[model samples]
Target: MPAARTRRARAARKRQRRMAGVEHDLSADEWAGLQEAWGGCAYCGASGAALQKDCVLPISRGGRYTVLNVVPACASCNASKCNDEVTGWLRRKRLDERAFLTRLAEVHAGL
Candidate 1:
């Protein structure tokens, strides 16, 4: 039980540090817009699956939960992508890396 408690405390502290000084947090409206704009999982194009907020740059690597960095992903893709850089992960998954990048850039430009 003491070990479990220590793990939990460490996890909480890590979350706090990750969130510290996080400006430009995504708002409800921005999230809705993202969903509409992507129309599916941003990585897998899995429409109608429950979406999770995924950071293109992992929070552990200094990414913030901001509009520009966040994308909607299916649970499968989100879990698979944990803490990995987006382009490399996409390549490993055999996904269309260039298409994703171009679409992301177009979306960012419109914002």
Candidate 2:
């Protein structure tokens, strides 16, 4: 048997979690934002991948629970990001952060 550390625990847990559907914890707008993502990862576009809830502006950095701050990210992206701010992480990954930039601008502008 494989050691516990070598086993795919997150995947196993994900399978178990699917039956319950992870959206129960989200607000109506958050669910809308998640559904708008079309089940693929919002960042890397990995289809049907196991996803995690991510805050575009991290709570630790003084972000809020507003729907605009939430996005569905694949487990790999989410774990790699940890508490880092969203736009900076995207920049470090060499991806265009324009959409987020516009959104952040709109948010700060009270849109």
Segments in model 1 whose C-alpha atoms lie over 4 Å from true places: 1-9
Query: For residues 18-88, could you state the per-residue lDDT of candidate 1 as single tens digits?
Result: 77856657999999999889999999899988999999998888898889999999999999999999999
- Give the poorly placed runs of model 2, Cα more than 4 Å off: 1-29, 99-111
Error of 1 at 50 (Å): 1.2
For candidate 1, list the clashing residue pairs, or say none. none
Q: Each candidate: RMSD to true structure?
A: 2.0, 7.0
Scored by lDDT, the top model is 1
Candidate 2 TM-score, true structure as reference: 0.58
Clashing residue pairs in all predictions, respectively, total 0, 0
TM-score each candidate: 0.86, 0.58
lDDT score, candidate 1: 0.92
Scored against the true structure, residue 41 in model 1 reaches a CA lDDT of: 96
